[model samples]
Target: MRHQPFETWLLFDDPLTPDQARALDEHLRACETCRALGHSWRSVASLFQASPDLEPAPGFANRWKARLVQEDQGVLTARYRWQSWITLILIANGVSLLGMLLGMTFFDTFDSLTEILLVLVYRLTSLLTVINIFQNLLAILIRTIPGLLSPSGWAILALIVSSGSLLWVLSMARLARMPGRA
Candidate 1:
């Protein structure tokens, strides 16, 4: 009969049958790997059997619950900070753009609608440039903040802002260059 692999040992808790026992004994004599596996399994089983079963301290569950709550709060706080910052930046940019258009259209007298629209477009472009400068400055400040200064954090922030600005500029430029538009 062929020798049994060590994995077969896990199938039976009681003593192996005569043929199976003989096969395992023969394999263990020839294979150091199988012998070591069997030894390790027995050692682990013995360790589990030897250890005493005891309940944790009275505050253990409470401590773990508190820890989980703290972790959740940390995640929520970070999410809210990011959202608020983005929202503020967006609102500032939108208000600035709208103010520029209103100033150019209503405050500055133009002889024709075309002239007024052209002025508004020019002002919008100028406002976008100003916004970009301010956004870059903000990114630099974020990167330099005392406890938040990390190369990876700065790199990620720079990447996100740069990509966003690039997309915004490209879309705006395309719209500005479209023929028949004021």
Candidate 2:
């Protein structure tokens, strides 16, 4: 049987009009499901009414606030790390381009295309060697540094490094924006 108005009337605490009340009564009588639902809803409502209100445990608010602050800090840290990586990548690309341009300028003195290509290959090999050396040094530093520093020490080190990187990025941006640079 269609429950409709009967289920709605049973679930809600609103006083029904005489017509709605008559319809709901007829539905409830015919529909076993609606009758059972109405009974269950009443039981639930009574349980809710009888349940006592209780206060939160002590320090709950303070702990919740601390958690929120820690979460915010984590988000900020992640953002900063992402931005730092992007800045580092941009800086590396800029340096590589500048190096290539300088290499091309130097190769301009050469008479033949073969000599230019040879010089370019030699410069690329030298650059790769330097990069490999730096990568090895970075790997060694990563392995060694964590054991040497406490959490606070690491934080301080991070702050110093980030500040330096920020200053460098800002300076580079300012220089790029300058009107007179060729």
Candidate 3:
């Protein structure tokens, strides 16, 4: 017959039947190999049962929680440190670039800028010269306008203007009185 299953008898959590125990005992008596294996297995099982279950030290959970909080604070502080440095670096670079641009515009391009400004002023002066000529001619015409008109000519112009205004008022009144006009 094959060797009895000694491992099942030794390692099972529940007690075995009487027939299985008797059969395992008979096999162990006949087979020295199986008997030695069972004895070693029993010793291992007894050692495991004798040892205590794993557990944390006292206040272990509270200490771990405190460590986690410290670690989080460290990470946040590092992140903010880098953020502040980046912002300061960007602002410094921007200010330096603006300063350099102003220096270049005023120092290196000063002569060319002055020439361009002089050209603009010359063009504006020429334009103002033409405007002054037109203004003088308009003044001369305004001064001669009264001399060009006689007393009878002024009277005739006033009469015509009065008649035209009266005609416009009568037309507006007639339109306002018309049906569907309101």
Off by over 4 Å in 3: 53-62, 81-182
> Tens digit of lDDT per residue, candidate 3, span 79-143?
99999999999999999999999988767654777787887899999999999999999999999
Question: TM-score of each candidate?
Answer: 0.39, 0.48, 0.38
How do the residues 29-141 of candidate 1 rate in per-residue lDDT, one tens digit apiece?
A: 88877778788888998999999999997999899999999999899899999999999999999999999998786856768789878988999999999999999999999
Global lDDT of each candidate: 0.85, 0.91, 0.87
- lDDT ranking, best first: 2, 3, 1
Clashes of each: 0, 0, 0
lDDT of 2 by residue, 1-182 (tens): 56776777888879999999888888888889998998888899899999999999899999999999999989989999999999999999999999999988887789898988998899999999999999999999999988998999999999999999999999999999999773
Question: Which residue pairs does candidate 1 place in steric collision?
Answer: none
lDDT (Cα, 0-100) at 127 in candidate 2: 100
lDDT for position 47 in model 2: 100
Indicate the residue-level lDDT of 23 in model 3.
80
Write down the lDDT that model 2 would get.
Answer: 0.91
> Could you arrange the candidates by TM-score from highest to lowest?
2, 1, 3
* Angstrom error at residue 80, model 1: 3.7
